[model samples]
Target: MNIVKVDVFQARLPLIEPFIISYVRLDDMPTIFTRIELDNGIVGWGEAVPDQNVTGETWHSTYDVIVHELAPLLIGKSPFQIDAIHQQWDAQILGSPSAKAALDIALYDAMGKCANLPLYELLGGRAHDTLMVPRVISIKTPQEMAEDAKRYVAEGYKHIKIKVGTDAKADIARICQVRDAIGEDAYLRVDANQGWSRTEALQVIEATQHCAVEWYEQPVKAHDYRTMRHIRESVSSAIMIDEGVQSMHDLTEVIREEAADMLNIKLMKAGGIYRALGLASLAESANMPCQVGSMVESAIATMAGAHLSMSRTIIETNEMVGPLMFTQDVAGVPFDGEQLLLTKAPGLGIEVDETYVSSITVQRACIE
Candidate 1:
């Protein structure tokens, strides 16, 4: 099938509430949603991580890159040759994984539609259709955090991931409050977002030993692999690396140095499904556990992650709750229940309602 045009929509959706963390806080999501329409009248959709602070991608930059840089590279290329397109695009952009990810996902969706197969099926099929995605409560006051955990449990979520990287004492108290509130039956995990000092991480992890944390992710900064290894050695709690293991280079270092017991894989950081799969393969070879994470995404990107998570062998946890957390989503099918489910339609197995889309789109570009 011949590729026709690439459409970039800059959209802003309100978060259910302002999501706070040590690094950044977001009340409104400013993102670029990409839709690739083929000449055969098939359309595939994807989302770019427009977190300017995290990836240096903003709505304007995403639109410019896709329309002026990426779209031209793929307009006439065979949609099924995913790798070839990536190789060409990689040569052009030195480090725009977030932008590249948007195009890559759209192209994959187009390929799946051309083949009349579900996206997961083309991605080596799926091992499990349903996965337990834990509910994440942003770090807050101990009392408020405990109430958040209780609310998640009341909503039927069996697991919770609390954001930390604030004061060690408050972080520990937050975890304790959550555990006590949710009771012993729910799984508990923490993401420090590389906000702690080595000493701080150590003290916090040691203090929370009573909380029975399933794992503590990126306790210290991303570059401090030495500290990561040290923390892994010093603590009884499992250590997972998030920002630390964003690329194959990072994955190599983490595995070679034995820096972590687990890793967090996010589509935005890993570039796309293919690169994500590569990271998973490396983790598999090293026998390391992985958790599929999100960078506040819509159902399109989250479902893309779910497809990858299912086909992989190492993912032990899931955090694809962006749709649930965001007040609005651009995707047609939002995640349902505690599991992130994909629709039965071909390709991404979802539809985009133009009405919802037009309501949220901050900008739009058409390449005719």
Candidate 2:
């Protein structure tokens, strides 16, 4: 089907609680979403969550690029010619991976709906019916963090990821605190967001070697492959590459160099399921494990990631907790339980809660 119209909407959902990391503290949540309609009246939805911390994109720029530039480019292209359209967009739009990602997913959604198939099936097919998605426990006081870990454990979550990269002593205390509170039943993971130095990463990993961490994600900066390799050798924890590997080419170099044990693929960071799936295949062929990540996106983004996670063959863990972190969710999908369940609805199968979404809109676009 040929593209008939593209629409953009900006929404700001309040966080249930403020999320603090070493680099930034997020209070108000923002999401830029797109809806693409074809000539025959099929519609599909997608979301863009620009990470200034990771990809250096902001809300306003993302929305503008989609509504003014990217949408116009897609107006007459065939929705099924996904790669050709994406490459054409990339040739024109500079450094707007997040904006491009929104359109990429929208095309996938549109095609999937038109064909009456799930996006995963359209991409390749399901590796498994479900994946173990990690639930994040935000940074807080030692006791408070431990209490938060306990709550997730009580909810039947077996894997818990803790946010660190602040003070060395406080971070050590936080890991110990959560371990003590949970009593070693839950699997623990850590995300430093590249806030630690090589020496600091070494020290932190050494200190927590006894805590049985499942993996350590983005310990040093993404650029410091040498330090990442050193830290991986210094500790027994599985080193997961998050911000470290941005594109398929980046992932290729890391794999060739043997930089780390695993990789974290966020659909937005990797661009979309199209590119994300390609990278996942590369990792799988290399026999390296990968996980689907989230960037404070609503259920729309998480569900998109979930489809990839389920359909991909080599994914082990998931950090898709965007809905759990937000005070209100503008989209609906099942993530409150231990396992993230697939929606029975057609295509991606979740409906965007437009009423709640409209209440938080900072901008809106119409399909002309």
Candidate 3:
């Protein structure tokens, strides 16, 4: 069916608490939601979470590209021609993967709905029916973070990811305190968000060696391949590259250098499911593991990630806890305490509450 119209909405949702990372702290998330309507009355949904620090995009830029550039290109295009549309986008667009991702996810959702199957079935099949989500403890005082960790564990979370990389000593204290509070049985991971030097990364890893961290992610800068490889060689903790591994080219470089033990694949970074699938394939070929992640997004994007997480067996871990971080959900889905239950409903298998979305929306645009 040909796409007849496209609608874009920008929603600003307040977080339950300030989300602290190495470089910045966020009290709310600005997200762009997309709806693509087909001539046959079928509609698909998508969302884009623009993080200037992470995806190099802001809400305005993402909205501009989707409305002025991508929407015109997509008008009258068949939803079934997924690869062809993506190929056109790649050739015509230079950057702005998050903008492309918004449309890409919508196209996939539409296709899945047309086939009367969930998005995962179209990707492959359900390798997992439910995904174990990891709760992220944003950067805080060692004691505060420890208390947060304990609370998440008490809420039935099995996995906890700590934000670090500001100070080696503080990071050490944070990890140790959290580990002690959680009683050592829970799985723990750390993401530095490119906050440390190679030496500092090593120091932190060395100090926290006894804490049993499952992985250390993006300790050094994203482009610093030499330092990343050096840190990987020096540390015993598995290194997961997040900002460093953006596209297939970046993944190839990381694989060539053996710099990372795992990859944090976000739909925003990989430009959506199509390219993410390629990245997953390449990572699997090299026997590298992957963690499906999000950019502090809403349930629209989180459900998209949830579908991708279950689509393949290569995704060993999931950090799609964006929905849990917000004070209110703009959409509804089946999320148990630890696992996100995938539904048999068509498309992304979730429904957006348009009224709630409209209440929080700051901008809107429509192309027909």
Candidate 4:
């Protein structure tokens, strides 16, 4: 089917509270929701969450590019030429992966709808029917963080990911207390968000080595390969690079330097599932485990990531708990305890409340 119309909306969704990470405190999330209608009346939905800290994109930029550039260009193109369309969009713009992701997701959504298949099946097929994810506890006081971990554990969450990286001593306490709260049966992972120095990363990893961290994610700055490699070698805990490996080149550089033991793939960073699939495949080829991470998105983009996560068995764990972080969402993810159940619905498999979405829209644009 050929694209006939495009509708793009930018909305500001409030977080439950201020979400504190190592480098930024997010009180709300700005997301761009895109809808594409085919010639025969089929419609597909997509979302773009432009993270200034992670993807170098803002909400306005992503929405503008999609409305002024991507939408008009996509008017008559066939959604079936997914790879070629990505290359064309890449040549059309530079470093707007989050913007490009909006369209890529829409195209994939439309393609799935056209094929009468669920997105996981359209991407390939299910590696598994469900995922038990690591619920992230954002940066908080040691005791508060420990209490938060306990709550998630009480809710049937088996894997807990603690956000540390502010101070070595405090971070150490966070990990240790979380481990004590969860009782060691469930896995504990640490995400520093590039909040630590090489030395501090080494300190935390070494201090909490007894806690059995599944892996340490992005401990140092994104490009600090020397420090990353040094810390990886200095500690027993596995190192998983997040911001450091945004592209294939970044992945190769990390692999070449022997920097990390695992990978974290985000759709917004890689442009969308089309490129993320390639990155996951490359990591699998190199024998590295990968996890699908989130960018503070709603259920729309998170489900897109979920489809990609279920497409392969190599994606061991998921952090697409974005829907859980928001105070309100137009759509909700189906969660059964720790497992995110796969929807059999075609495309993204979730029907969003258009009325609720429009009520939250700060900006809206329609192009045909």
Candidate 4, residues 253-367, lDDT tens digits: the string is: 9889999999999989999889999899989888999999988888888889999999988898789888888888878789887788887788888888899899999999999
**Model 3 Cα displacement at 279 (Å)?**
0.4
Error of 3 at 23 (Å): 1.4
Candidate 3 minimal-lDDT segment of 10 residues: 330-339
Candidate that scores best on TM-score: 3
Identify the candidate with maximal lDDT. 3
- How close is every model to the real structure, measured as TM-score? 0.96, 0.96, 0.98, 0.98
Indicate the TM-score of model 3: 0.98
Please write out the lDDT profile of model 2 over residues 244-318, one tens digit for every residue: 777888898888778889999987788777888788889988999998998878887888888878786788777
lDDT of 1 by residue, 1-368 (tens): 77778888878877888888878888777777888888888888888876565566766777788878887887876778788888898888876777888877887888878888888788777767578888888878989999999998999988899998988889988989999999999999988998899999999999889898999989987878999999999988899998876689989998888999988988888788878888988898989988789887887888788777776658867788888877667665545668777655677777777789888887888876
Residue 6 local lDDT, model 3: 95
lDDT of 1 at 218: 90
Q: For residues 268-333, what per-residue lDDT tens digits would candidate 3 score against the true structure? A: 998988889999999999999998988988888898998999989999888888888888988776
Give lDDT for model 1.
0.82
C-alpha lDDT of residue 174 in model 1: 90
What TM-score does structure 4 among the candidates reach?
A: 0.98
